[model samples]
Target chain A: MLELDRVGVALGPKAIFNDLSLTIGPGESVCLVGPSGAGKTTLLRLAAGLLAPTSGEVTNGFRETSVVFQEPRLLPWRRVTDNIALGLKARGIGRRHRRARARELAAAVGLAESLDCFPHQLSGGMCQRVALARALAVGAELLLLDEPFSALDVGLRSDAQQLMQQLVQERALAMMLVTHDLIEALRLGHRVLVLAGSPAALVYELPVTTPFNERTPAWLHEAAARLLRQPLVQASFQPLVDREAA
Target chain B: MAAWVRRLLRGIGSLTGVLLLVTLWEWGSIRYGSFMLPGPRDTLTAMGRLAEQQALLAAMWATSWRAITGFALAALAGMALGLLAGLSRTLGRVLEPVATVLLGIPPIAWIVLAILWFGSGSLASIYTVAATTLPIAFAGAQMGARTLDARLAELATAYRLPLAQRLWDLYLPHVVSYVFPALITALAVAWKVTVMAELLATDTGIGAGLALARVNLDTAAAMAWVVLVVVLLLVAEHGVLRPLQRRMEPWRTGH
Candidate 1:
């Protein structure tokens, strides 16, 4: 479990997120959905321990944590296999074992043939998969993903979402994902947190009763319609709409 | 374009450039008599004569040693200091101006100081080459270090990669890309500075042989020595540097 205990974040006197308390349980996936500049990335960074909160505490109960940034962050010099093996290499795993584990993850992420190839040779979606493989290679207890599938096309995105959801359930992994796409959040997360205000505050929490695997397109549509009915959900977009209108 | 076709075109273009240069040299030699400027034929004969004398090999080895030694030393020092400077803002600000000042000074200016410090021999020639080439290597290393993506640094931190692994896997690869190209340029500068220093400061090396040829008004011998140096430069650039550079290009592994 990862806990953000009434966390407050400020950058140069301006508050970004304030008194935000959230917990991702041992077998739970929580998604944060909000507009741009709502500090979604900053929140991810805070959870990953890349940034410290201004006030309150972030308690990490997991043995290991991994982050998937918006970018692939693959080493250009390293081949796909080596990139996937990065965490394993850091852990002092022997070359043979590291190679074995990396190959497994590469296949897990549908990049079996690209094991020998460089990151530059892979497509954007493939590179993201390599990043995913890297995270999985570490055996992270809590995985923090910031728009991991935003760069992919709709077909690829759904495929990737399916893979991620399947892995989460199979491994009983805990995840904290931030995305602007409500449907994606609804599909992957056990619970979705909606952030609103100029500097974001957790305005609403929607517990996704439907399991990720069983949720159909019809259910997703009905759920989205139900979410749109919430005044706060509509209000979250108001600021962004007003800014664009101006 | 196909790799083989591209390579063949580049080879043809290079040969054409060399022929054009030789043609221009021949024209210049004809305009001025062989006494003043030797033709390719006269220069070739003079080179053959020197080879027969067995002096050409010794002179070539002596000058080459000085150039390589000085270049190697400069590369090590410049890269070390450049990493320190590039990683720290305060160090970069302090050292960047010093490098710029060193670069602005003429290579000729360094030879006089080098001779005074090391006295006339390989030391002076080597020192002069190092002094002249240091700024180039330093600049290359600094820029290479600067090209590092901050996002990668964050990634490394998140993953908890060991310091040695970070340096080996991330930092060195990017630095080598910048450093190797600069080293190629530095190699050219090293040879030029070594020869220039040897002409004035030393009684041995190819430069000294050129001095001898000059005093005796043997224009063909001087041109032959010049040709030898140019050929060596071409070998180092095309045979060594270009091949190494191609291998270092990380994206080449993509296909």
Candidate 2:
């Protein structure tokens, strides 16, 4: 479990967020959906204990947490298996045992064949899968993903999302993901939260408790229509869609 | 097979350049007269003469050993200080000025102080070389460390990578990239300073041999020593350093 209680963060002269708070309970999948510069990534960093808030407190109770960054962030020097093994290696697992475990994780992520490949040699989607595999290899109770699927092709993104859904549910992993894509948030998250405005605060929260892996197109459209009906969520969409339509 | 051909052609191209230089030297020798500027042939003959006496090999060994010893020490000190400075803002602020001051001081100035302290042995040469080269490695390390990906460090911290694991997996690879070019530069400076120091202070290395040749007015022998020094530098950079770099960063080579 992770909690950011009434957090305030100001970088230089600009304030990113004031009096913002969030909590991700055990086995909870919370997706943060926001405008382009809504400090979603910064919020994730705050929860990961990477950045201390200008005011207020963050309490994280998870024994282990792993993050999949926007970029794959694999070591260029390491092979796919080695990169996956990194968290285990850091946890003092032996080389032979970690390698075996890494291969297993790679298989779970559908990257077993790429175990010997370098990051540079892999396709973008494959690289993202490796990043996912790496996070899973940490055996962390909490997984934070920052647009990890944003760069992939739509079909690949769906596949990765399915893998993520399966694994998270199977392991009962708590997760916080940041994304701008409404459909993705709706597709994968148990609950979706939105932020808007310059010094943003949480504006809307939607709970979509349908079994995500089994959700239909009709369910998605109905949820989208409902999300669009939220005054604050609709307001956040106005500036971008109105300008694009004009 | 294609790779081999490309490699062979590259080798041939390099050899051709060397041959061209040798031919130009021969022409210059004929024009200037052998006494003033020896031909490559005359330099080779003098090398053989010195080699027969075993003086050339001994002097070469002496100079190379001193340079290498100093280079190794400077690398250790410089990299350690560099990492310290990069990792700590206060240390960076303190050391930046110190490294700048050291860099500003000439190696020749250090040679005088080194001789005064160590009294004209390899110690003076070795110390002068290390003192002159430290700032280069230090600067490289600092820049490398400063620019390292913050995300990588964050990942390491989140994973609770032990200090040693962070070092081996993350910090060292990044630091080494910066350290390498500096090491190459430091090596060149080490050789130059060691010889200059030996010319003034010691009597056992190639620098002393060159000094003796200057006194006897044997231009070819002096030229031969110059050739040997250049050869040693080439061998160190190409033979040892490059291969070591390739071994350390095999991932960088193909893709």
Candidate 3:
């Protein structure tokens, strides 16, 4: 289990998040959805241990934590296979074994043919897939994704989401995905949390039962739109809506 | 056929331009009737005489060795110092100003000081060349180090790449891009400054040969020596520098 208890973060006198708490049990997928600058990214960063909260603690049961940022962040100088092998190499795995593992993961992600290609050669979707493969290869029980598929076109985005669903199911991984797109949240997340207001607070929590792999894109989009029209979510948008009405 | 002919015409035009300049030079020399303005024919004759006496070849070899050795030393030392400075802010702050000052000083000033310390020989010339070239290498390496992608470094940190792998795969590749241009510029400066230093503080090398020609009032031979230096620079640029630069730009292979 991964838990964040009363997490508070202040950046240079500006509170981005305060008293924020969430938990993910084994094999559960959670997504945080909110407006831009909602501290969704910050919460994910905290979970990954890439950032520390000003108040409150994050508890992790696993030895490894893997994060996939919005950008692929692949090393430009390294080939795709080598990039996937990065975590293995870091853990002091033998070169031959790491290479084999990287090759296997690359194939699993449909990137086997691009093993020798550099990051610059890959398309945005391809690069994200590589990033996904890299995170999976790290064997982290908890995966933190910060808008990992925000750059992809619609078709590729659904394909990547499907791949992620399969991987999460197979590995029994706990994940916290941060996204501004409600459809993405509805598709990939078992539960969705909303972050809102100044200093950032978790305003809403909703359970989503639609199996990520079984849901059609249309179904996900409809559910997502309906959630956006909810009293709480619409009320959060009241200021802008009122100004437009006037 | 049209493309080939156009290329041929462009080449011929360049050659004709050079020929026209030479023709003007020869005509002026013949009209002036002065040794100072010796014609191309007279310079070439002087070159032949020097070659026949074997002095030209010996001088060329002496100058070349001093410049090459000095450049090699400067490249090695400068790159090491640059890496040190780049990796540490304190080291950069302490050494960078000193390097800037040393670089600002003229080669002639270095030659005079070198002569006082090492006496009038190739040692003085070598020291002068190395002094002039060191800053160029250091600045290039420093820029390379500073400009390396921070994201890549963060990735390296996240992955926890081993020391050896980080140095070879990350640092060295970035360094190589800076090293090539630095090496070329430093080598060129080393060659020119070595000759100038040799002219002032040495008794052997092309600079000394030029001095001997000047003493004898043989303007033709002096001009011939100047021509020889230009030719050597061209040869080195094509034979050494260009090949190395091409080899370093492997990423441009397909593009």
Against the true structure, whose TM-score is highest?
1
Considering just chain B, what TM-score does every model have?
Answer: 0.93, 0.96, 0.90
- Which has the greatest DockQ? 1
- Which model is ahead, 1 or 2, in terms of TM-score? 1
How high is the lDDT of residue B155 in model 2?
A: 79
How many steric clashes does model 2 contain?
A: 0
Q: Score the docking of each candidate (DockQ).
A: 0.72, 0.60, 0.35
Residue-level lDDT tens digits of model 3 in A38-153: 78888887887767789999998866778888899986667888889888877888989989999999999999899888788889999999998888887888888989999899
Determine the C-alpha RMSD for candidate 3 after optimal superposition of all C-alphas. 4.1
lDDT of 3 by residue, B1-255 (tens): 698999999999999998998999999998987575999999999999999999999999999999999998899899988888887889989989989998999998999999999999989999999999999889888877777777676566655678887787678878878877888888889888988998899888999999899899999999899899988987898898878776655443422
**Candidate 2: lDDT of B38?**
97
Q: Give one digit per residue, the lDDT tens place, for model 1 in B157-216.
A: 999999999999989999998888899999999998888999999999899999999899
The best candidate in terms of lDDT? 1
Off by over 4 Å in 2: A1-26, A51-63, A153-156, A169-172, A197-199, A209-222, A239-246
How do the predictions measure up, each by TM-score?
Answer: 0.95, 0.89, 0.83
Q: What ranges in model 3 sit over 4 Å off?
A: A235-246, B1-52, B89-94, B216-249, B252-255
Candidate 2 lDDT by residue in tens digits, B33-139: 99999999899999999999989879989999999999999989998999899989999999999999999999999999998898889999999998989999999
Give the TM-score (0 to 1) of chain B in model 1.
0.93
lDDT of 1 by residue, A133-225 (tens): 999998998999999999899999999999999989999999999999998899999999988785688888999988676799899888988
